[model samples]
Target chain A: VEFGGLRAHCPEAALHAARAAYLAGCQATSNVEAGSRFGIPVSGTMAHSWVMAHMDELTAFARYTAVHGARSILLIDTYDTVAAARLIVSAGLRPAAVRVDSGDLAGLSAAVRAVLDAGSLQETKILVSGDLDEHRVAALVASGAPIDGFGVGTAVTTSADAPSLSGVYKLVAVERESGMVPLAKLSPGKRTVPGEKQVWRVARSGETQRDVVATADELGPPGGVPLLRRLMRRGVPTESAPALDAIRDRCRTAVAALPDGVRRLTDAERFPVELSPDLDRLSRRVGGRDDQGP
Target chain B: VEFGGLRAHCPEAALHAARAAYLAGCQATSNVEAGSRFGIPVSGTMAHSWVMAHMDELTAFARYTAVHGARSILLIDTYDTVAAARLIVSAGLRPAAVRVDSGDLAGLSAAVRAVLDAGSLQETKILVSGDLDEHRVAALVASGAPIDGFGVGTAVTTSADAPSLSGVYKLVAVERESGMVPLAKLSPGKRTVPGEKQVWRVARSGETQRDVVATADELGPPGGVPLLRRLMRRGVPTESAPALDAIRDRCRTAVAALPDGVRRLTDAERFPVELSPDLDRLSRRVGGRDDQGP
Candidate 1:
């Protein structure tokens, strides 16, 4: 994952984006701070500027490999992709990967792969990048391209198509002169449920089946696990936060437990998230729509 | 300017986005860090959560205005735009401005304006904000919406349409045994000019007419002002940086001096930017195509 696009927003965004990508099962990130802070492996190829700085493509490749050795992921699209791969093989420079950052990635990766394989450099992987999103990546994979890795930047970091989330913090309850009173808004297109809530996840054979949003005071349903824990109280943390790696592992496992229909990228089936009987009753009463059935 | 959207990236980006919006002639920012760091005025109405926290919309308005007084900018769209305005006027709450954040802004602004005027709260201004960009702002202005100010966020902060800038730092010249040698990249679709360069802006009648990109050593053309200044030499300071307010003033003045065609929002005429004769000659020579005419 290349989080450089996130840097356009702020330095902290870069770190957060790197962590998010890691938690989403991304194997590596091109952010150094993420590597040092979260232990996510840092990997990236050279920039086009590096190649332009040298006298020729071969010299740039040779110099970079000399310092980084086989770990160097040569950026070959600075001049020509296939030609650079041939030059690397002809000069016996073994790079961990060759990255193509421009042009038709699916077609270019195949051509570059053929050149590398012909030179007995089958171990050198092919990495493709440039305006890659989930749709493009899926299409590339479906096309049977020889891409070993993908370096996604802007689309993932900026979430360009839908740049903002609509999450809001609502006051579910307020302290009155008498006691704590549950609250709810009847605003048009801006309604809210009353009182504090909890989400209980029901799993079957290690796969998540559904989730129930219920009043905080309610007990978990049979065979269901409470997902919310008191992490903070009275302006202080209630417990030590989990390690970054542990959190990442949990995220991976959670995603894996999602049903196939819900996990699909396109036309995804909505995961069941029903309101519990207690919460539903509270919502109707607070909204002043007691006649409506649950 | 509502730079809250920029916070999605990083804290630093929030500061920079606030600065950029301020330099672009935005009067105020919603970001407090920007207010302290850049001395930009901070202004914001209230969140929906604030309204929902109270027992009723009127109570929310009364409580907010009690603290903020006439300076309060009440958010009216939490329930109903016109109804909220009517409520504010009937309750004798004189807010400085009323903000609308949803629906047809053009239609709602006029309706809210009518309500405020009917109640003899003529001094109360109408502010509108949701997903405003330059185009939407211009259209609103053209449609004669009585909008006093705009709270722009995602569009200005993220530059949603074109998010990432394609800027790359290339090695222009190398110090060699003999002397400095200019370098150029012949990469397809990624060519670069040789040597260090400077931009000379030519203005007439206080309006910028054109700019010339020339070799650093070349003399400025007649009536041309050099735009690049050396702030440091060998990593040491050569001069003090200008204060943020002073820089903001300079930016405002510079933008005002642009020709109307170049400043127009839609299908704007491209500002003339040509390479100087000396630089053009050098580019052809460095590209190894010396036979090509300048």
Candidate 2:
């Protein structure tokens, strides 16, 4: 994934986004800091400016290939996609890939592919990118376009549709003279579940089931695996952090175990998360709704 | 403007956004880094979690006021806004301001204002913030809501509607053995105008009329003011950077000098920007369109 868009926000945000992208199974990233920090492979293609800097497009491709050898990924859409591909092949230059940053990606990729094949440069891959989002990538893949890779930036890094996370920290409990008292906001449209809680993921025979949110002291249901662990205590880490690759592996495994319906990109089925009986009763008591409950 | 949203993007983005906000006349920011870097005042209100951590809303307000004195900006929407305001008055605590983070801001601010005024705490100001954009702030002002200040966050910092800038560095000229030669890209929908250029802002009296883009060596039209200046020479500073306050003043003057139509928040009239005769000729020649032009 190309992380150039990350530089438009904040360094902390870029770091977090790079880590999240890695955890989500992004094979390589264009973010050098992320590569060094997380041990992810760093990869990138040439920019259109590189091609424009030289006297002509063909000369630019040749110079880049001579310096970077077979690792060079020439950007071919500076003037024309098909013409650039033909020129590269005609000059006997073999770049690892050619990226099309604009135009009708699927159609241009097919046309470029044909030209490359005609010149016997079949090994050169076609990469496409330009304001690409999840939906666009899916459509391109569905169209069977001969695209070798996607260099996504803006959509993934900025999260254009949902730009900011709505996560908030709430005080679930406050220590009092009596030890500890559970607290819950009665604010309209902003209520919080009171007290410490634990989430138990119930899976049976390799098929995942629903999650149960119960009070921290409650016992887990049958075949339920606890999902929460103490990461820090009293401003200090409780244990050494897991390696990035190990965390990525766990993320991949967890995502693969999800049901097909819940894993869909669009119209995804909501993953069921139920409140345990004890937790439901506690919620009722804290919310002053116990009069209506047994 | 609260710059918390800037943290969601990148440090460079945050710095640029903070500078832009300062230039656009933002009085203060919640970003301490921005404040120290740009000389903008740092200001912020308490979080809901602060109120939630206390035994009750009244106690939280009392403690916050006791510590911060009249400078305290108490968050009043934890459980109930009006109730919290009334509680503060009844308990004889006078905070500098009360901030409402959610609900119908106009109605709540009016209600809270009435409660504060009736209790003779007329000096206390009212601030409101909750996913507020320019439109919402303008609407609140138009409705004559008794709000004293705004704590905008997401919309301004993230530019929710237009998340990213489409700026590009193009190769406009190349130096060779024969001297400098201008170049222009013929890329579809991404053409460059070619060569160094100067932007001249034409103004009459105190009102900005239009802008003219001319070739660098071309003479400016009568009453035209050059907008670009050299900032660096051979990787060294050409001149000391202007003070932040001076830049802010310049920005204010420039914005105020714009025509009313062009300054409107919605349906803003596009500022006219015409190409000068010499630049037009250069463009035509570089684009190989001289055959069609006089």
Candidate 3:
């Protein structure tokens, strides 16, 4: 429903992020473009604007439900959440869900759940969304809020908490007349590791133990699987990309293989990323003794 | 040069924002699509990745300058800032400018300027960019940093400080059987004024004094100039949009007419947005006593 919230900012980025999220195990997206482009399932309710567009909230609900029918997930918090809940039942319109976009979501979800149960509308789910991130989602789950699912925006689209990832395409190695010469930025607090690299994931009994970033030429680490594969060659794709469902399934399996501590929503333990001996040696040679010096 | 720094995240949003900035007084944008779409001047240099791809920083600089000639703006902070400066002058490639992408911008710019002047490359401009915002630019100017212009990203494209603006497309009035009926959301902390509205600005001697948001039906306030004009009737545009240059000029004039306090880069005073008498009356009537009630 709220894909427009982020889409209004950047249609391209929002579509990309939605596709990524969908391919990373998200059940559905509200972005129609994401659905049309990637064949992902699209889901949404109505916006507060829809309710605000009507003379009265009840009329808005009736008109929307009349048109959208059982597919309607009426937005309830535009004026009064509880009042809207009572009104939805009183009008005898059965919507798929009632969404709470603002206010205390956890408490309100519980309260709304009670209202629906009291009205014997047990099948009607409650959906909540407001500045939702992983932490908030975990908190709501921990509190046992009766929210069936989430409608996340802003945070996911913007990558809010850590909006920009620190990625540097540094001079790892340069093609020289004599041979490949290692290169690195020795800038203080911003030194680069030298060489074309590959990540080696070490798993023990189906659980990831650690990852080693190594020079691509190095012999494969014992009991390690290479994570990076050649995706393209000379500006052409090496092979067709996997189906979105297959990728999502692979992601689910990989995530399930993580240790519980590393999977926690908040204060999760960091996974160890070690450098291979060859890469470390090259980095030291290129970076010199004082790594901080420019 | 650094368009990718911002473009990598939100291509759609960045392009839209770039076009908007171009139309609103910005001279040029680094986005190619923005330029192609809006016929705005496109500007850019090379990223660190381009330099890092070469055998050596100096060789990279020489090769780029050899091809691009005087139009090239050599990015100097990829490896060593000062060393790159000396190499640029020593290699006898007088680039149009030298850009600093990282490190202490204010101090580095001054130091780079000294190097350029000492090398007798006085005409070669100094461009600096790294996490720069309006406040940072103002501070750089205040500190007498010899910078030519800026390469602002992230902040402008993402509206980083306040990413999302709360805009509501509410039904001010609903068409009814008899006539149009005013409507408002009485939701706590989100109360809205009813009826179609128009903003009237009261200016004296070219500086804006105040703005009154009035019911559309209300007669124009004395000495007030209407700011909002009908741009479209039904779906079709009322008229072709004004030329980008004209809009840019108008934006510049409008910005210049702002009060100095409101124009400050930091700790700026808030501009008052007042409601018209009729609108205020309607709000009170719609709100009732204890407007916080559900």
Candidate 4:
């Protein structure tokens, strides 16, 4: 998500963005205490390239700390996890985290933890990262092995299960000379509900929700307002837009409100999306039953 | 792959990149022509979102064609592809291509082709695309269907066979006052070959040859020179770098040259990468042995 390799990247933009979010700036090792206040975790891990560039594990740790900060997790499995852990402890940097990138997560975690305990360094944390997803994270935690936060990358960036978002925009209701005409596309099984649309959610007791589609000129169901509110007007963020924390909270609520079926990992039924009569009529007028259009 | 959405997006960088690559700039319709000129087949399929946006396949076709050119394929199965093919032909456009994004490839292709032939527009090519890879392509071609080209997206992007490249760059030789020193990393199982490496690949005596690696400073076995010519130096493409077409040809050659074992569809023996004795000696000085600095 961070535009690391873009042109005109000064490295200061990362620092500034972090600061604006009231989070730690880049390579700010002393700001671990700021974690509680900012709620943004200080994190990074050893790349295979870095491990190979430096000759030895100890030298790699020394150089990494010199460049990044003292809190750098010495990558244990560059060759052997247990052996590297022993060397890292011997170096006396206190080894904030011992990361295992590849290999059996449960077995490696158990063995590494044992090695740390055997060395009497109880403070070292275990961080596991490599192709981890929410499902995998839940599974790993369920296994009763001790591990801290995840370093999710490509899967998150790519959203592998659903890479492309189907979010779309259309001229649902365009201003016209005679009257405000409601427009819609009625393409076989791909017919769209017509008019400037508003989606209202009817929540029965508990976490259940039913979505209703209505015309822009009319009010929707008695309860929830439209989920797709104006995010921007004429190419600028609106002042009332929620802050990141608030947005995260809203997201938590939205995801939580899902009635289980929609959130399932497999074949899931879509939530109901019934339309108002006026919108349905407008759709019929524009889309057509036969191939004829007028 | 195609943005598909027609929103009034601002002149942002990401959108610009997409616009440059896919939208309206020498847009490729068919593969043979695209491959001949572009050197890479620029291809795509009609997304379901587009199908769903419009009502009735014919109306959808009219709207999409009114905006984009008529040279594009008609996605038939948004409702029922075979039926839609009749409508498209009746509409007099006689589409250049008819895409079937889903359903039984063999059965559907045969049925649709039968229907299209009954209408006497056999030249209206049938292009099938849905989760196709090299294996599926080979199979479909073997089955003797009339697919013009492929619209490879997910498998190509993800590199499903080998998700991530195991390529690692290491500082093999750093200069010292005494002599050029070689470095090696010995972290557990991660033992690296030493030396500022030159990967010299010697082809075994034939057009279809297996390659062996050698040090750049050393002569190749029999007659292999060097493969590790600097691809990029001081942020410039090397003169040795071929044109796009030539590079594609070379890729075809190298891929063809891959040993039958390496090309197999399973866990295979890795290509051998050799190290020189001088580099090994330097590695010993740096990290070849156990224990820390003397």
Please provide, for model 3 over B1-294, each residue's C-alpha lDDT reduced to its tens digit, 9 standing for 90 to 100: 224335345566566788777755666788888888878888777877778777568888889888998888988987779888988888788999999888988888888888889999999998887777778878888888899988877666655565454465665666666676677766666667877888998888879878999988787678899998899889889899888788878888888888999988778999878999998997787666332222
Kindly give the stretch of ten consecutive residues in candidate 2 chain B with the minimal lDDT sum. Answer: B285-294
Per-residue lDDT tens digits of candidate 2, residues B1-294? 564543346556666677777688877887788888878888777777788777677777888888889899999997778988989999999888999988889999999999999999999999888878789999999999999999877676676666655566777777766766667766678778877889999999889999999988889989999998789889999889889889989899999999999999899999999999998888778788332112
Please give the fraction of native interface contacts (Cα pairs under 8 Å between A and B) kept by each candidate: 0.36, 0.46, 0.32, 0.14
Q: Is the docking of candidate 3 incorrect, acceptable, medium or high quality?
A: acceptable
Put the candidates in TM-score order, highest first. Answer: 2, 3, 1, 4
Give the Cα lDDT of each candidate: 0.82, 0.82, 0.78, 0.59
TM-score of chain B of 2: 0.94
Q: Which one wins on DockQ?
A: 2
Which runs of model 4 end up more than 4 angstroms from their true locations? Answer: A1-42, A45-150, A158-197, A201-225, A233-240, A256-292, B1-140, B146-184, B187-209, B214-226, B232-241, B256-294
As a whole number from 0 to 100, the lDDT of residue B12 in candidate 4 is 35
Error of model 2, residue B263, in angstroms: 2.7
Which pairs of residues collide in candidate 3?
none
Writing each residue's lDDT as its tens digit, candidate 1 over B167-249 gives 65677787655567787755556678988999999998888999999999999788999999898899999999888778889
Alpha-carbon RMSD to native, per candidate: 4.4, 3.7, 4.0, 7.7
**Across residues A59-88, which tens digit of lDDT does each residue of candidate 4 receive?**
878888787675777777766678888887
Q: Candidate 3: where is the Cα deviation over 4 Å? A: A1-8, A49-71, A104-111, A288-294, B1-8, B23-27, B49-59, B288-294
DockQ of 3: 0.30
- The sequence of per-residue lDDT tens digits that candidate 3 reaches over residues A87-124 is 98888888999998888898888888888888889999
Q: Over the stretch A159-207, how does candidate 1's per-residue lDDT look in tens digits?
A: 6665555465677887766667777756556678888889999999988
